[model samples]
Target: MTAFVLIAHGSKNPKFQEIVLKVAKELENKEDVKRVYVGFLMGKPSIEDAIKKAAANDDILVIVPFFIAEGSHVVQDIRRKVEEVVGNRKKVVYAKALGDHPLIVETLYQRYLEAVRE
Candidate 1:
């Protein structure tokens, strides 16, 4: 059973946590993914905790940093955490940061149009 851990920076704003959970929930329905976990660097279900959860199965585990760019959090913090937990593991992959994707631009444009019309 592989665990997909979505890591996000903790924010005082409740909306941040809500958004992370929403993303994790959406990923839960995917096939071959045993579990989808959400964690924050600061708040409850800390990044370390999430890593531990993903390490439970001792199988493939993917850590996805929910960041807009390839900053220190994704480059440094997440890398260090993955190394600490899954030492010489079978499969541990870290996804790249979400950057300038065409889908994002299109979605933003569509949302903007709706907001203006409303």
Candidate 2:
């Protein structure tokens, strides 16, 4: 079972936390993924706690940054935090941000098409 830790910039607002939890719930439903845990750098259940909670087994861990760009959070902060927790684990993989994916472009295109058709 692989655990996916979705790291995002947490907000103080309760609604933002709710949204992140919703996304984690949806991702947990996917096949092959045993669990999806959401963590934040500046909010509750900080990255350290999230990692500790999920590192119970030798399951493959994948950290997905919720940032839109390869900025400081995705580069420096996340990398350092993950390295601290991962230690000698070889199954840990840090994934790219969702903004760089082609799916984002496709979604934008679909939105534009819908607007034009309206």
Best by lDDT: 2
lDDT of 2: 0.83
**Considering only N, C-alpha and C atoms within 3 Å, which residue pairs clash in candidate 1?**
none
Name model 1 segments beyond 4 Å from true.
Answer: none
What's the residue-level lDDT of 72 in candidate 2?
91
Error of 2 at 45 (Å): 1.6
Residues 1-118, candidate 2, lDDT per residue (tens digit)?
6779899888879788888889889987888777887789989879887777777754677889888889999989988887798786747889998775799889889999999999
- Per-candidate TM vs. native? 0.86, 0.84
Maximum-TM-score candidate: 1
How does each model score on lDDT?
0.82, 0.83
Q: Assess the local accuracy of residue 68 in candidate 1 as a C-alpha lDDT between 0 and 100.
A: 85
lDDT value, residue 95 of candidate 2: 91
Output the lDDT of residue 8, model 1. 96
